[model samples]
Target: MSQPSQALQIRTSDGIVFDVCLEVAQQMGLTHSWLQSERGDLKCSDGPDDDANVMPLNRVRSDIFKLVLDWCQAVQTVDTPLEHKEMLQHQRSLFQRILTESNATDSTIFELIIAADYLNIDGLLQAGTQHVADVINGCDSVEAIRERFHIMYEGEIDE
Candidate 1:
């Protein structure tokens, strides 16, 4: 049998600790960089009790970080590289399910985008920005797009 995956602890800005597998952690650019750094000897262990190993993420909130972790875990399940079209299809389906299940708002989605960008998770960033773009593209008019994002129009000021 294969060995159990090493647990990597991450602490969010909200002081929530999440124990993630090494595979998922390695997929995150910032975390992967840390894993490769000489000073990045995070106490990788099988158990989550070791608080000293926790990587603190100052910009990511627990709720949003949880979503990012979930996304990485789910995406990692597909071992093989998929075609471009297939990847887009899978991403769309996964994103739709996440949105429906979480009942996420536009603000939350935007926050997730920011968190993903901060973490340098390219796949997640693409998916989130694509989702926002798709939403705007589907809008019937400029007013609808503004309404969707809760943007209010102000009169133009003199240049």
Candidate 2:
């Protein structure tokens, strides 16, 4: 008989751990070619094992990691109701509300982009980068960009 794939234990920098299916993780691009070599036996070449395959994501914050995982789960499922324009609008509103409630700032979005890039999650990288662009689009000045991105310039300005 064939054995089923095992769940992977992903530990974030803040000590939060998530048990995710290998297939789902791979679908999110969380697993790469280098991971197999770096993690060695944790890749489970033979079959599923009882021990959790620990993958430490020391660079990503726990909350952001959870958010990405949630996004992955959400994308994996099909929602028929969301096809309607009204429903889609409502969902977008809800998403915005959640971000507002969570105090998700531009810095958070940038962090998500960095984490996504490091993890090779193309979907997240695209979404995050697009979000940043959308925020800065049509803005008039460098100050506006800096303010929106919560970045401070320490270096000397040219001209």
RMSD (Å) of each candidate, 1 decimal: 3.3, 6.0
Off by over 4 Å in 2: 1-5, 32-52, 79-101, 154-159
lDDT of 1 by residue, 1-159 (tens): 998878678899998988788889988998888777733665546565655677889999998887888788889889899999999888777777777778899878999999989999987888889999999999999999888887877743344
Question: Over the stretch 1-159, how does candidate 2's per-residue lDDT look in tens digits?
Answer: 889777777778997777876666775555654357556446443533433466778889988876677656655565554555664454344445435656887667678779878888765666666666667895789998887666778764545
The global Cα lDDT (0 to 1) of model 2 is 0.67
Which candidate number has the best lDDT? 1
The C-alpha local distance difference test score for the whole of candidate 1 amounts to 0.83
TM-score for each model = 0.87, 0.67
Candidate 1: list runs displaced more than 4 Å.
Answer: 38-40, 44-51, 156-159
> What RMSD does model 2 have?
6.0
